[model samples]
Target: MVVGATGTTGSRVVARLSAAGLRVKATSRHATPVDGARPVRFDWNDPSSFDNALEGTDRIYLVPPPGSPDPAAVMLPFLRQARAAGIRRAVLLSASAIPLGGPAIGQVHKALPDLVPQWAVLRPSWFMQNFSGNHVHARTIRADGTIRTATGEGRVGFVDAEDIAAVAVHALTDAQAPNTDLIITGPQAVSYGDIAAVLTEVTGHTVTHRRLTHESLRDRLAADLPIEFATMLADLDRAIAKGAEDRTTDTVQRLTGHPPRDFRAFAEREMRRPRSRPV
Candidate 1:
């Protein structure tokens, strides 16, 4: 089963798993059609949705809900239900910034392994798809060729969501459980300025990165998100500025047997694809 099946990485995981000839149950808040898989409605707040989604599924790809101040509060009950339903393995999507027992999803990261017979935690760096998804950065880039952040010049090895999905599929289907936390990242680190330059070269637009104070960034995010969540996001950006995410890892290559795609490759592929109307 793939929870949050319609999500950025979850959707890809579902597709890849199905393509590999595995029976997959993909779940979302609504019954959205997923090719080559059974679609089920599942919501974190609703326990009644759990049984149907967990039926006939032994492994699960977990995507935590967004804007969750405490993900464990929303995810733990469902995970317990999954265990009772006989689900044996789980692959959890976590962030590189949140270590085991740290904060947010880290709580789940610490408990998931012991809760299930087999499990793997994926701690991925900033996603390269942020520039193409419906995120604030993507919207700003599409609307005015500008990327706004409080990250200053902090470098990050932005991992591709596709690579994340591939590694997830491996973790979900491998005969022997990895039984460890995987720090997934791209081949090299790049700053927001470097991303802007890559965007300029790929999209033929004069893309630029605008640095903002953490306070200003928080205010901007609070316009669309809760104040507390906005403040937390801004603080993450501040951490980035302090070089918290400035490193690369071989986890993706080691697990998936291929080098992780770099930001430049991602930019070129995104440019070649038909552009979608900005959200």
Candidate 2:
């Protein structure tokens, strides 16, 4: 079973699992069909959907809800329910820089290792989907040709969402690597400047990364997003500026037995796809 199955990563995970002929159950709050798979109405805020989503499910793909004050509190019970339901293997999508117990969902990641009998936390770096998906910065860039963030000259080994989904399928259906954390990344580390260049080349427009003061960025973001959420994203940018997410890893290649895709390749593919009205 895959939670958040209509989301960027979850959608891809569902597609990949179904393509591989796995018995896939996808969860969404809305009634939408995933090709060749069952779409179950599931809401994280509502516990009533848990049993329906986990029924007869042996392996599960979990994506934690972002900005929750205590995601662990919400997920622990779900994990317990899955265990009780005889769901043996679980794969969780986590962030690369967020070490177990460090901050954010770190506590949730840390607790899962001891709680679940078989689990793997996928700590992937910044996703390449941020450029073309629902990310606000991507929308601004598509509309205004400028991407604003507090990350200054810092690099990230941005992994492609497809690569992450591919790895997730392997962890779910294949041999279970219990109680392990996979720090996944692309082939190389590149700065936001590099990302801008690739995007500009692919889109044939001047899309650049503009650095902003953390305070200024926070204030601007807080206008639309919750203040705490804005503060957390700004703080993450500060951490990026400090070189926390600057390193690259081979975990993606090691796990999937294939080289991770490049950022430029991702940009070119995204450009080829039909886009929505500007931004």
- The most accurate candidate by TM-score is 1
Provide the lDDT at 249 for model 1: 93
Candidate 2 local lDDT, 1-279, one digit each (tens): 898898878999999988888788888888478877898988778899898888888888999876674678788888889889988888998889789896767888888876668889889999999988779868988789888989999889999999999888888877646468888899988888888888887887888898999999999989987888788778888989999988888777877789999998888888644567986
What is the lDDT of every predicted structure here? 0.91, 0.85
Which ten contiguous residues of candidate 2 have the minimum total lDDT?
270-279
TM-score of each: 0.96, 0.94
* Highest lDDT against the true fold, candidate: 1
The reply for model 1, stretches above 4 Å from the true place, is 272-279
Model 1, range 1-279, lDDT digits (tens) per residue?
999889999999999999999998889999687876898999888888888889898999999988887889979888898899999999999999999997789999999977898999999999999999797789999899899999999999999999999999999999999888999999998899999998998887889999999999999989988888898889999999999999999998898999999998898987544568999
Give the poorly placed runs of model 2, Cα more than 4 Å off: 272-279
Checking candidate 2 for backbone clashes, the offending pairs are: none
